[model samples]
Target: MMQLEQFYCRNYRIGPSESDFRSMYRPSAMLEHMQLAADGDLNAMGISTSEMLEQGLGWMLLATDLSILHPARLDEEVSLFTWSKGSKGVLWLRDFILTNHEGDRIAEARTSWALIDLQKRKPLRPSAMPVEVKAYPEHSLGDIPEKIILPEGRQTRETDRFTARYSSTDSNGHMNNARYADLCCDNLTPVELAAGIRRLQISYYREVHMFEQVIIERTDAADGIIWFRGMAADERGTVFEAKLQLNGAA
Candidate 1:
């Protein structure tokens, strides 16, 4: 059983405004919440890129699935509870629950990470991080949720592309995982689509490293569902997959 550390955060006024429903809550903001929570865990583990590698382990960005329950407004003093669920060998899991001051649930999210050898990029065993940081109480453990399925890939109907930059990649030397969600949302036709996001899932097939070109592909899987795939066109095929659910609202 893994014991999770609780994080209490005060919501700020810098979040997305109420101009429209789609932009009601930016994926970037949610990503920020996840980043903060992960940072806290890493600090608790006393594991940095250099420190972890000394123990025959390095960090690898994996995947994230976020579900929104309510909109967190700017400057709204909300509490975000985060904790590490479990880790099997090299793979690590973290869960988060965002709530208001009154104990109302706002959003829930889960992300996957891996610790690997810095030189060869191979996974390391569980004894890498310190025992206290790695050991988490399991009595209140929540079930790991499933990632959304990408129905299919489709030929892109639009010609817009986001320019790749070096800053997008994190310490793992790959494009920051959260930015992929932004790329998928950037491709949306704002005029035609009018809905709030309920769920988002992304699977990383390959890594998009520094100075690489990435192409965004979209798929319409039927009514009320859509899929987006991103690929690094240098030599490798696809790199990542993104799926989103948007509700049509007036």
Candidate 2:
């Protein structure tokens, strides 16, 4: 087991803007914080984004499984630790742990990433990168699924349709991975949003570019889990899919 001390960690203070109506940190904001910590870990390992992009290559997220034990609130300070769990073929795995100022666990996540050729938009073999992989300790949240499967035959409906805008893009020039969480939540009813998300798992199938319209579909709630799927409106295929497990209002 990799120990916490072996990971690269960063501290963050929850600002008012990062919280929701209940003052709890928003799911999107938490995802962003995890991303920042991952970036920090990559930088520490001499695997900066600029360095990769210089080679006409970049990292793309394939999936993420996040479990929120206790969402942080405004004015609360938390520490986020992230480390690589090594690579397997073209895919690399990483894990994150977020702890409160009192050292209590708050959240944990496991993420899978793949290297891609920026020009061709094709995945590259892990060997294409010069960086070395090191296994780290896994968080207490347990192992995450390599893929999230949506239950079939559930009552489904078209929730919303919208076009991706420049503002929704990230440095990679595609829809930001964190924004997917926001989009998923947007499909939820007010009551569902108020229930809040206790756990979230997302799988990215294809990238969505600016000006591309997307159709959002969601399955009726089943045992507190709501499943969502986003597809390109033009028949470009599936963009991403997600499952959210809800918790009662805070």
Candidate 3:
């Protein structure tokens, strides 16, 4: 049986600023909270990120599948619960739930990650991890597909191009993972942004370093469903791809 102590929990308050004048928490912000809870969980266990870095190991996110049940309002206190869902082959999985102060679930996510060797920049198998985490078997989003596939023969449009700024880079010296949602969403029609995001799935293919340029494109596949791909301006291939599902017709 899974014990309560095995999961990690943290609380946070929504800020005054919000997404698209809707006073709703943005996907990017939710992602930031997710990262915080994951790090805090490991940190409390005496395996902090810096410590892992010193050992030439670090966590890298490959994909995330999230669902926003209800929009988190501004200035509200919320609790985030996370757990290490264990590792399989080269992928380590984790799951999370965001709840209001009332204990009602508002959001949940499933993610796939890799523990990469800092020096070699390659993913290590679960058994090869220097540190061990007791993983539980609960899956909040059920099974996440091993891959995120964009629509075949999908139409694409070049929407915008920009360089990764200093503020956008994280400790890995690459564009912060959370920032990709904003990069893709920024290309959406204002109506779509205002409609609010109900679900989002993203896959990271490569890293974008500080000051490196990226080209973003958009393709709408179905009603309330939009896909985006960010490619390296220098032709390093796709940096990331995302699919956003809006709440309703907008």
Q: Which candidate would rank higher by lDDT, 1 or 3? A: 3
Local accuracy of candidate 2 as per-residue lDDT tens digits, 1-250: 5457768899979999888888989888888888888888878877787887888988899999998998789999999988877777788788888899887889989898988999999988978876865566344345544587666676668889978898889888888888899898888888887887899999999988899988999998878888898889999888988888999522
Q: Which of candidates 1 and 2 reaches a greater lDDT?
A: 2
lDDT, candidate 1, 1-250, per-residue tens:
2222334243434344422354355776677667766666676566554565456555565677787777765556666677676775566877777777777887878777776676787766766555445434363325443544455345544334555677787765677777787787777677424455767778776677777887777875346556787766674887777777775521
Candidate 1 lDDT score relative to the true structure: 0.64
lDDT of 3 by residue, 1-250 (tens): 3333447999888886544467789889899889989999888766888888888888889999988999998888999989887777898889998889988889989999999987899998877665568667664457853466677988989999979998899888788889998897788787787778898889999988889999998896478888889989999898888888899834
Candidate 1: TM-score? 0.79
Q: How big is the positional error of residue 13 in model 1, measured in Å on the Cα after superposition?
A: 5.8
Q: Which ten residues in a row have the lowest lDDT in candidate 3?
A: 139-148
Which is better, 1 or 2, measured by TM-score? 2
Scored by Cα lDDT, where does model 3 land? 0.84
Candidate 1 differs from the real structure by a C-alpha RMSD in angstroms, to one decimal, of 4.1
Give per-model TM-scores: 0.79, 0.93, 0.93
Q: Rate the local accuracy (lDDT) of all candidates.
A: 0.64, 0.84, 0.84
